[model samples]
Target: MSSRQRGNFNYKLAFKLFSSFFFLSAIMDVLAEANGIFALNLLKTLGKDNSKNVFFSPMSMSCALAMVYMGAKGNTAAQMAQVLSFNKSGGGGDIHQGFQSLLTEVNKTGTQYLLRMANRLFGEKSCDFLSSFRDSCQKFYQAEMEELDFISAVEKSRKHINTWVAEKTEGKIAELLSPGSVDPLTRLVLVNAVYFKGNWNEQFDKENTEERLFKVSKNEEKPVQMMFKQSTFKKTYIGEIFTQILVLPYVGKELNMIIMLPDETTDLRTVEKELTYEKFVEWTRLDMMDEEEVEVSLPRFKLEESYDMESVLCSLGMTDAFELGKADFSGMSQTDLSLSKVVHKSFVEVNEEGTEAAAATAAIMMMRCARFFPRFCADHPFLFFIQHSKTNGILFCGRFSSP
Candidate 1:
């Protein structure tokens, strides 16, 4: 081959490889952002009373549903793909591959922090899942297929799955399936669990921790153990009148907590309304913040929340998956089976040292920014997210309203 031709060939090869990587990365981002929107919408639905605290893992729920989507056919697949933000750019196959790539990237060991994500498929012994579907799930989602006697021993099967979840999440999450959550009619269950433990890149001073008043509402105030720290971190100003954002990294830069504190006078509802997946991306961009000295006062709080997500997901346009006759999961099994229920539970604790979190989701059948000089005192109702910085995957998101 001529030298000019060889050079052109090399250039084309490099471009193709780069584009491939970029394409997969982009799809991961889309899935992550779509999960964010789903989280917000669900939170809105769950918090219609607007007084209760909200917390859960969007990533855990998404991972479990994505596994189900792999077996979904026709409109069932399309609705899920849309709700989960699975783009059709590379079609279905590439979408699953992208999830695999992103999962591998996030779960790769060797960091100062610990993050473990796992999935499992628990099916009744009588049901025969497609070989191709089983292989794809194991290959892409790292989920192992297990047979449980859900038909004869529903409670035993539920306990077994919940125990597995607790083990995977380091016991932070327990009792993912409540009594009667899994019944004799249940044939298949999919579960995903994620656990994270990390020390702060800059730890808050234990000596500086003290009781501070937290404004839960216009009329209610309660004392909370507020942790304090002073460090140079990324900061930005965002949303309504005077909302501020701060990014706090854990020991490993791979994962970080993004906090959005609205002004004392402004209600958190304002912040919630303005939060969208696209806006979240825009606010978290590295370019949005310049390193500056920030005095942070955050409450040391633990939140645990559980939700039966059947109706929540249906409201989000994923109706067909849960319907017995309407659902199409032919790709999974020749015998007709549809999703029965979805349950999710999450736990998060933040203290002077850092943060530890865990979440679990089981499907029985169906599926920020501030200014430079500003001090961030999370003493009022505020929004926060613990996210994987690389893939922009939100592990846990919440609004802290009360002590």
Candidate 2:
């Protein structure tokens, strides 16, 4: 080919690649937004009881349900999409591809932290699932549909699934499927597990740790081991809500913890009620935060929480997917399947060194941080989030109210 012809071909190739890159980035952004919206919604639902600690992995739950959504049709698919904030114009394919890219990006190797997200489908051995559905799951979500004899060995099947979840979460989450969670009617189960262990970019000195009183409410207080450190970190204050926002980076800086602490006089409910996807994005924008030397005092705490999400999802306008006759997962199979249950369990521990969090979410379908030189002390009820800086995805989020 002549030099001019070769130049034209190369230019076209570059343009095509650029367009593909832009498309992928846009999809990721959409996925992130969807996650944020779902996360906040779930928080609102789970936070109704302000007396206890609430912690869970929205990422794990979203991915697991997305796998089910891959095969959902009609109203089932539409409800799932709306609840998940995945009503993008690109349709289901776009959502799946976006997750495909996200899973790959999050699980990429050679990072300073150990972060892994995995998915799998467990179906009754006798059920006949469409090959297209299986192929799409594997192709888009890297999830394989495994066959189990749910009819003959109900307990065995449950144990097998729990074992898989435990293995995926490095044993942090065992017994994800408790006794009787799977029975003869249980035809399918979809599971997603996320595990993360990372050290802080600036570790807190153990010697500086001291017992501090954490205010649960105006009338209640409890003693906690507060970890302290003085370092440079991104910090900001939302005067409108009387909240302080701080970012605490993990070792790699790719992952960070964001803490939102309402003023001592301000009720956490005030901030929670005002939280929205747009406001969260604006509050945490890089430009909105400033890096400065801060004295951080965060309590050393651990939380393990579980939820049966059928009612929760239903409350969020996802009733059709969980309904018996109304559910339509035709894209998966013609077996008239409906989601039977969605169970999620999460564990997290934060110390002077860093943080370790593991969560597993199973969809049993039956036919179904920083700092604050200004002294950012999380001595009261506050919210926290572990986010993937690169994708702006919320990996885990919770509220530490009692402890």
Best candidate, TM-score-wise?
A: 2
Q: Which regions of candidate 1 deviate over 4 angstroms?
A: 1-16, 87-91, 239-241, 354-373
Specify the poorest-scoring 10-residue window by lDDT in model 2: 358-367
lDDT for each residue of candidate 1 in 194-286, tens digit (9 for 90 to 100): 666677876776778999999888888999999987667898887443688889888768888988888988878877777777777888787
lDDT of candidates 1 onward, in order: 0.79, 0.85
Clashes of each: 11, 13
Q: Estimate each model's TM-score.
A: 0.89, 0.93
Per-residue lDDT, model 1, residue 2, is 100
Tens-place lDDT digits, model 2, residues 1-403: 9999999999999999999999999999999999999999999999998887989889878988999998998888889999998896445588889888998888888998876665788988787899999998889887888989999999988998889889888898888888988899987776666666777877776777999999999999999999987666899999999999999888768999999999999999999999998999999987768987677899998888888888889999999887778999888888877776688888887887743330011011101132224788999999999999999999998999997
Which stretch of 10 consecutive residues in model 1 shows the poorest summed lDDT? 358-367
